[model samples]
Target chain A: MKILEDEKIVGLFFERNEKALRETEASCGALLRKTAKAILESDSDVEECLNDTLLSLWQNIPPAVPKSLRAYACKVIRNLAFKRLEYGLALKRSINSELPLDELEAVLFDLKTENEFSDVEFTLTLDSFLGSLSAESRAVFLKRYFFCDTVPQIAQDLCISESKVNSLLYRARKKLRSVYEKGAEL
Target chain B: MKKYRLSKALGEIDEVYIEEVLKYTEDAAAGKRRGIFGRKRIVTLALAAVFIAAGTTVTFAAACGGLQSISEHFTAYRTDIKGVGDTSSLPVIENAWSIGKTMDGEQDALAGSIKVTSAVCDRYSLYATIEFNAEGIDIPENIPDEELTFDIINAKSGIEGACRPVFVSREGDIFTYIIHFSESSSINGDEIFIEAHNFGRSCTVEIENIGRRLVFNSVEYCRIKFSIPVSDLLILDSVQSLNSEKIDGIIDMDAELSPFGFVVRYDESQVPAWEEAHSELLKQYGWEWFKYSTGTVYSLLSFKMKDGSTLENVHNLIATAESGSDPNSGKDTIHFSFIVPVDISQIESVTYLGAEFRFDAEAYD
Candidate 1:
């Protein structure tokens, strides 16, 4: 199916056309489901979260015109999925021993209670840190942390071994830890 | 400070990063080629299995039995070759021919001899297994897991391409290495030179009995060269003219079917209006124009097969756009390679842009 462009879809949302939701789902539903499925274990919860993401896009696009609709929908779905996982709305299925959430623990370990940096400042720091990485490493980092992709899924997609994926994640986390420590010190 | 907070912060980073990641996932989900070289180690191993199964008798004493023999003593290196032990069982390793040419290597001080055992090539890349024999040398029991690097130098042009060691294994005194040579440009040549370097520098052998490492500091101790002929590898070609309303211009596409994958080449210069729109977007958004672009030209190219399956996500191995003297002339050639090797006979029609071009089955014969 030839999916509509992001601009057209966003225009539909602004015009209050119901077709906008279907178009957005057609274009980004797979990506949103994959991202949400990585976090929320249950199928029902994932469907619920996806519906919420579509509604959120419908509600927010008129007042908030995003630069990229796919990126905006992805952000919404991920936020909703993480919220579902945190609020005990869904039973967390075991996604390997080292969950992506737990993997970030070491990076922010030094920033315990006294860290006062705002989320925006931290995001900027992260942006700079991501900029320093190689393109391949940055993709792997974002895929694991942001998209919550499993190691095997990433390995298969990238045509690399599971060990290599783990290695990239390990090195990226180590670098992120150093960046986080520097930010905390500031 | 919280993990959720960190995750949320990451979500708020520049949309460029998010878009980049999304592009990778989309391509991957669609089974598109992942990296620039697009040399999948499993695919290489699968090619090796196909070559051996096709009854190409390689003359090398060490790597003659193909991946099966090498896996017996296979040791994991930094870059692990996935599924080396079970290449023959893979269902994807089909419709490939074998190249059983044996090329003699230059004798070196580090070892007795080096030779190219089993070899295969597609239009874009070359895969070969090299056997390094270290006979009559006081070798160490423990060899470092470091990779042995090499270069594929064109015999005629002398242009060099980097070679990656996909798999490495050791017997008593001989070491076997399966390497892949891929370049951004077509790796076309009648003959090529394989220069294996950094043998002792990068790969150090630890003399366990003496409790010391045997590091060959001299370049002669590490370097070995081999010359091989690659003229026998088959690449099928066809030309078709396609006009699509979805795209601004007519497409004169040239498709090449190699043992590895399909390479679809077309001149985008024919579409002047489309090129102008692309230029306008680039001028408007700078580096961020890629995010705004609706879809890539390669996305419009797919295959309709004889098995009643349409192969989507033809992973573009490499896309190079070359412009003439007049930049606005929009003279550009795009090459898209399928992720997996499809039987040329099975490809019934090619959908280029919005136009469908049918193929005669007798052409593949």
Candidate 2:
């Protein structure tokens, strides 16, 4: 199927046209598959995840006119991939994903058991912290962690050295740790 | 805390971060052709997400540019900027496209209410669209464009400039004002104070002695003020000037790569033959009679990359050809500001109409 314009594809979905899914697959299938493969190893799970994502889009797009379909679809696929990972892990299955969560885990390791903040507060604090960063530094951090790209991948994409990417993450973590420590003191 | 708990917190950060990441990833995957206009919307959406994620109850409604000035320019290129597209997936020529902040709420004006709907700014210009609602007032058609005026004040830098409406339209109870300011006006600050006023007069054109004239009737003055906190914009401090070979000896084209956009400046008086040939056409096309100093050159120009790729999705092509002697060149000048940002290093040439002005790669230092 030929790739249709985003608005056209959305219109098709609203009109209940099955071609909307085909067009979406035509445009977004490769990216979704790549994102799923980054986290999930099994081909069968990846295929099932893609189907689940499409069903979710069909249900969601009627009420949600997503500004960027790519972002919306990718987020859905990423969430589904994470869910699949969790399911696999519950069965004691070893996963091959070296995701950015591993790196973020190190930064948040010092959160004391008696911290006063909830998850919502932590999320807000993180948003404010990211907002305080310079545009370049923020872009680098998001590329590495939020988008689940490797350090070398981010370095190459931004035309920077791998060491620079490491240093940026170091500074970001240091800043986050400082904020978290302060919150703990409060 | 357990490591798994930390992972959970990271995953729950918010949609704003997700949007930003997706923007970069999508842009990389798309190979960045789509244009800055699309990315600009994503930037706005992300801005709204930031506020919403911060627990603000303020809802974000995308207010695209309603400027005929900008819309007309983009129309020729087969792009409609009035609606959202996959702008976040586009790569910028330079980082000319920066995100803008939304206002906290609508500001009540003397006659009605006014709201600054959207703004896309760089060091060179702050392009803002203001929406005006005059509830009880019955606005008639054919209101003279000269009745309203906009003044912008940079709160932090204390710099101020006046803006003329590039585009203005009324739909029933609403009037949209689209305006811009050049770098000389100092648009670098992150927060701006806007004062929009309407002169107490109603005017119309009258044909007298084979000439058009503006006649005005006195009315009550109406004013509104708005305070907007914007984000940091790109500064074009490293501007480079390129003087191309003289065109037919009458004009020497000089171009500057500014953070706001690409500008091509030339002597307005050099092309008399061009003026004489296109005076009637220019008038019929709604160009100001007095400001028609330069010959009618093609206003719709194209910026080309090194690989012979044309920037087709660019917006805001503002051209000013007024009669003013240039202080440096001592000649009347015509200035063209194409809001499409370009990487000077990557740009191979600028094509205006059919004339190709190629840049010397070796001279770029």
Candidate 3:
């Protein structure tokens, strides 16, 4: 599962190695499954998401060499689980996540509609949303979500005023809460 | 969801989703490690399926600065040129005769002859290997690739039939050439010359050399290079030009393709498989074909009729098999054999099996 270990095993994945693929799933199974479970709250949905995520990873990784194999798994599973969550909604009209949904609500609100990042159906939507936010807003968001980046770390990472990180967090949360209640239809 | 789980999920989103994203970080890291030499040789078999890119060991400085030059000339047609010559330009080609073209575009030399198919002036150090079998060629698009071809001819002009090369050195029997292209490929107005030299039994044709060194080691799959010679020209030297305009004209030959002979010559063991237009053969050669457990694979027959005359006429005719075992493997080397068409000289284009096909093979010598 490690991207840059020995190139032979890496080559197996590159060669569409079925055994190495089976091993990849087995190796990363626990973390991927647990991550999916936390987001979807359904074992069946989590399993489905894990399978889809792995398949996409298998298909995409040859061209896209990930820096951190673990981060790669996280990015894929999160986006897929989120997309499935959107589709399983009671109605397309309920485009916004409920504030109580808690985890993805902040990032989801700032994100553009899914159709905007069409070719990049995998992670493009999230990337665009993160890009559109101010550098401060994104740093705080990643600190809270992407990296569990601490307040001090975010301050260091952003080279910014510590208060700026705190304020960006508060503003992002407030906007997400309103958008969640309004339920932007898209 | 549990509170602990929720926090964990939020904190790990980037890690969770890494699989599906196209991360180019590895490639970027390669560039930073050592300018060009520090970079890993990533042979991305992106589009060309069987293309074997060994991240060719191109010298670092040469690769970076020469990539553009490598691609441009490799994509263009080359013509025959020579800077030095002990040759002649008169009515006699082998000292005692002249080659004469028939009214129907057929050529005749007394007994011995050598004709230049095409040639080009190459300036870059490149190596090429071109092979012709039934399975077509597979040239790497972004790598330096080359192919050379040659034909035998007689030098005498008084003899009226069957002319071949005169005194083709053992080294001269093989011609040599090179090509290097990257990223994109073009198929417009390209030509290469196959020299019929008297160098020896083998050919001694010269190819490209860059940075002032001859690239003579990197050849694969053909012997035409024996008759060719790599000239010592650090600067581009125009190859002696011939009246032949371009070498892109197709060859129409009735001579059975070599792979066709592999099966037909050994038809004793698998007669049943050979009956129908062998579906498995077609599939093996990367054709869209299907095979039943029994006699449903091949659909082509030798065009038979109630009359014996039609049967006789069809004996040496050609038709491609439409079936094979595994179509996508592209490891197919179907076996077959048939007489070379007597009127092969009338046709100009190289004839291939009757289907849309692309091979790891390149231009003919």
Candidate 4:
């Protein structure tokens, strides 16, 4: 939040509270870049997303009067970058044709399976579901999903395991689906 | 250094959407200013135009359609010698096509090979009449061979150019040729003539000197030159699958390669050094096996949920739809699959998915 336009720490960017901007980028920029890079995979796209995040914070700080600067920057950058990726059609131009996900889709969400859950009224609940998880777990989940990093990549980042990363992801997905099903009375 | 890598990571990200949001805010501010005293409408419009233009370039490289071929043959592989002798049953192969290459290092040689071809010009002290292959030739997508392996080396003694394979395929017919006439420090040798099984198809075979005279002693080179006939050179293989319930997958070979004269970790007990080296070489097999496999291993994830879509789906979507490397599995497809549980809650809910995914990978020789 750019609440303090002159708060010495946030005063580096041309005397425009640069510290707040810097802190926002340092803290949230990492997460934001990881997410953008995962989806876009293009160096230019990821960098663009990061740059936009900083500029957005710079422009929005005065009037919006933010509270959590990191959160604000991340939210903005992530949405914008994701739009670029989606409309940009990154998914359509996949490099990993043998990606296990598509295979699972072939079986898991085949016409028959989707037909069963079509009217299941799945509200897609993640708020409490994630709130229950430890911060570390949430980070892993975010890194894995948000950034689409591999288990080893996440393990290297979190200093965990390729196996542990997989375990956590599996449990999280299964639990989330079950909980969502229950919420939807599926 | 890590910070630099991180910066490089963020250098190319986009923020157009963020710019749009700010533009909206700026617009609102400008509108309020204009409302005060019959302000200039042209001024506000110009300001908005400037804001939009500022964020317009949007030089974003969207990972989109880049599938080079329908069926891929990977040459990189990881080999294990202990089990290799037990060719009891083949590894379970799946929707994949793979090839393995290893440098001939048994005699402390670099990654070069010596096959006795018909073009053997023995008079010139040439062991094998070898001709180099062309640059890139179109190879068969569907073949019966399970796990193709090539003993490749940096041109060693008696070889000249890069004896690389140039595959160019049009429609169904394929034209493949191997040419070996260039190298870091070697010369092209006579061709071991071998009649082409398929007409108009010549197997280019060039040989490099056995002992590499690398310019810098510290930078010792490892050369591998394979001298097989055009027919033999074209080892059309697929991951052969055995029908068995024990393993619900296809059986493929794993090959490995290391720096010439590179030491192996486990060369003691019973497995010979060559055996160990052979096994390690299997890790990278033409990138075909890896490309098709679903793994949480290495650059791949075993399971992930993105907007209700599995990580596997997202990855394969990008991999299948686009061209050139997966974000996770830098090589073409899932190089190796490992299962690791990732917290899905951190990502957007099932409907609000991120690019995360998961799947399994199992390969055998």
Q: Which of the predicted structures, 1 or 2, would earn the higher DockQ when compared with the native?
A: 1
The order by descending DockQ is: 1, 2, 3, 4
Stretches of model 4 off by over 4 angstroms after superposition = A1-31, A62-68, A90-124, B1-365
Best by lDDT, which number?
A: 1
Model 4 sits at an interface RMSD, in angstroms, of: 18.1
Kindly list the per-residue Cα lDDT of model 1 for residues B217-324, writing each as its tens digit: 422245666777655332333223332233334444444444344334434323334445576655565422122222453465565767676655342322222111
For model 4 the local lDDT of residue B100 reads 14
Encode model 2's per-residue lDDT on A1-186: one tens digit a residue: 458887898899899899889999998898788777777888899899999999999999889887667667877887788888888888979885677777776776756632477778876777788887755567778766655678888766654456556766876776778777777776
Please list the residue runs of candidate 2 whose C-alpha ends up more than 4 Å from where it truly belongs after superposition. A64-67, A113-115, A183-186, B9-16, B25-365
Q: Show how many residue pairs clash in every candidate, following the order shown.
A: 0, 2, 112, 167
How well does chain A score by TM in each candidate?
0.88, 0.85, 0.52, 0.65
- lDDT tens per residue, model 4, B180-299: 222111112222232211112222344476543322111112333233322112111112112111111222112111101000011011212223344444345422222223231233
- Give the interface RMSD of each candidate: 11.0, 13.7, 20.5, 18.1
Cα error of candidate 2 at position B199, Å: 12
- Model 2 CAPRI rating: incorrect
lDDT digits (tens) for residues B1-365 of candidate 3: 12223333443334323332222223223323422211111111131122213242222232223323323332221111121121111001010001111111122222223222111111211122221221222333343222222233221111101122211111222222222111000011112223222212233456556334323222233322112122210111111111111111221111112211111111111322232356555456544211221122233222211122111122122222221111111111232222111111111222122211111211111
TM-score of 3: 0.24
Worst 10 residues of 2 chain B by lDDT: B34-43
Q: Which stretches of candidate 3 lie over 4 Å from their true place?
A: A1-9, A91-140, A143-168, A171-186, B1-365
> If the candidates were sorted by their lDDT against the true structure, best first, what order would they fall in?
1, 2, 3, 4
Judged by DockQ cut-offs, the docking class of candidate 1 is incorrect
For residues A52-148, write the lDDT of model 4, one tens digit per residue: 8788767766665434444456566656765665455545654322222232222223233233332212212344555555444556555554445
Q: Candidate 2: deviation at residue A164, Å?
A: 2.6
Most TM-score-accurate candidate: 2
Residue B227 of model 2: what lDDT? 66
For model 2 the local lDDT of residue A57 reads 94
